[model samples]
Target: MQLISLCSGSLAALGAVLFAYGNGLSKWGGLAVLLLGTAVLLLSLSLQRRQEKEVTRLHRQIMDFLAGKNKTPKFSVNDDLFAVLENSVVELESRLLLERENTRKSSKRNADFITDVSHQLKTPLAALKLYCEMDQARNLGAHSQKQLALIERMEHLIYSLLRLEKLRADVYELQFAKHDLSRLLEQVWEELKVLYPEKKFTIIGTAELRCDAYWLHEAVKNVIKNACEHTTAAGHIQVLLETSETVVTLSIEDDGGGIAETELPKLFQRFYRTAQTKASGGAGIGLAITKTIVEKHHGTIAAENTAHGLRIVMCFPILDGVLAAG
Candidate 1:
């Protein structure tokens, strides 16, 4: 429309100039031409502004639709392209919402199944443990002793599985508070020390963060215990704490030969054990539980092979309010 208006105005100006020239009115013709050009420029500017406003309106509508702020967008009947785009966006949003709902239902079903199975097994497992205890009390033979040990291990595995599923399903409540990280690490080390007295454990620094002390202890203990299992007797396991304005990082490094590079990504997966770890009798739920706990605290955990051995790092964000309080 703007282009046609400009072309028509140019032709009119040309005709007026020729008429004025023939009638000896060149000055009037010049003024008429200037007026025509000005009108055409104003019209074009008006058309451009209207087009821009239409585009801005369409963009906002699309954004609102996608954000679920608006369920139905007002479509422009005059603009076929804009209408088509709006329909496409609405379709995409519908598909995304459906997929999300399906995923949520599936996760809930899986969590419920795990919870039910864990509950069912607990009763029989308790009975089995009791029976084994009774046999041991009667001075059962070595074979019975081994069976009792296996049963205990199985009980532990079942408990760990339930805990992992609860954490993953967000049913586990974490009590968050500002706690001294150094003291927490010390507490974990104290318990681990009794289990693996041959391994050397050290805490090198201090920090304080808002976290669930109990769950965080569980996470840290699991990592350190895994480190102990992988390391040689008398190997050094160092826990380093470092804090910055934005993050607090806790690193556990051990002199155990690091995991294979190919298996690094699978470390946090439930029941995923490398050949070496499988031989060590790990059910592989520890790291998975640790990852869930860290994520629940809005933190990140990663494992990497260091020059000396393996380093598992957990980094927690320092909230603005916490920084201010500090």
Candidate 2:
């Protein structure tokens, strides 16, 4: 750069000398030299700005890195322009390692809590399910049947709560692997069909979707089961799928009574239930679990009401894979 600047100055001075002698076009020559000097200055400044920006960008990325410490894996940015980025990344990673240690301790506590609760609940729940299946169950009337059904619902609630708490402690347990989405959805549908024998379900797309097979399966199953629990016996549930180069969307719609409009926003929060059916079996964590699993895969889930009933929509990115759109 210095050599270029010196060369430009020499040309300008030389142009001045030529004009002083008797070249009539010396004025144009000098102006051309001045423009060349300006260009050199601009180039040097632009390079400086780019180098500075690379440093600032790395600094800003660190803030996001720290913010995502618990939720995302650690990352590093190594650039030749900002050699300090490597050191900073290493230090930040050491700090993240400490953070992970703290998280592990907290996770152990939560796991212990869940384990105790499950152990305590398991004994009675097992006895209840056993008693309900006994000869005494044969003699029970409709009112008694309702009581037994409530017990079964409570049993499911206990199991789901335990499952969520365990997963919540170290959510990374949700595995990701290549699997056919169509087959998984079929399995969830078959299970829900038998569970809700009176309802009808239809799958609407022909293309195969690839994603975290088991987690997606659980998410879809929970959503469908939640819909089935709310739906009437004669209602219909439709699974409409849309795919593109980048994403796959699965919309599960039911024809039961829709939820209150005001309650829609809180649907995915743990332990929150709609007033219309608080007596239903769920502890309100089903949707929350579904949301967590989807988000871990960098996907999204949303709930809406159709003219007839409720619908849950899930979208998964087609990561590192390609498929035909439908």
Model 1 per-residue lDDT tens digits across residues 54-118? 67987776556544576544444555665776677667767766875686577667778888998
Give each model a TM-score.
Answer: 0.65, 0.63
Candidate 2 C-alpha error for residue 126, in Å: 3.7
Q: Any idea what lDDT model 1 has?
A: 0.81
Which structure among the candidates has the greatest TM-score?
1
Error of 2 at 125 (Å): 4.0
Show pairs that collide, candidate 2: none
lDDT by residue (1-326, candidate 2, tens digit) is 45665675666566556556645567677666656666766676676677678768766655545444333434445556355655667576677768777976896788778779888988987787677667356876556566677778777877787777666566445444566666787899887777788788788884455556776788888888877877777778889888898887889898877898889889999888897558674578889888877776667888888789888888887754221110
Every model's Cα RMSD, please? 9.1, 7.6
| Residue 273 lDDT in candidate 1 | 100
Candidate 2: Cα lDDT at 276: 52
The regions of model 1 sitting more than 4 angstroms off are 1-107, 139-142, 320-326
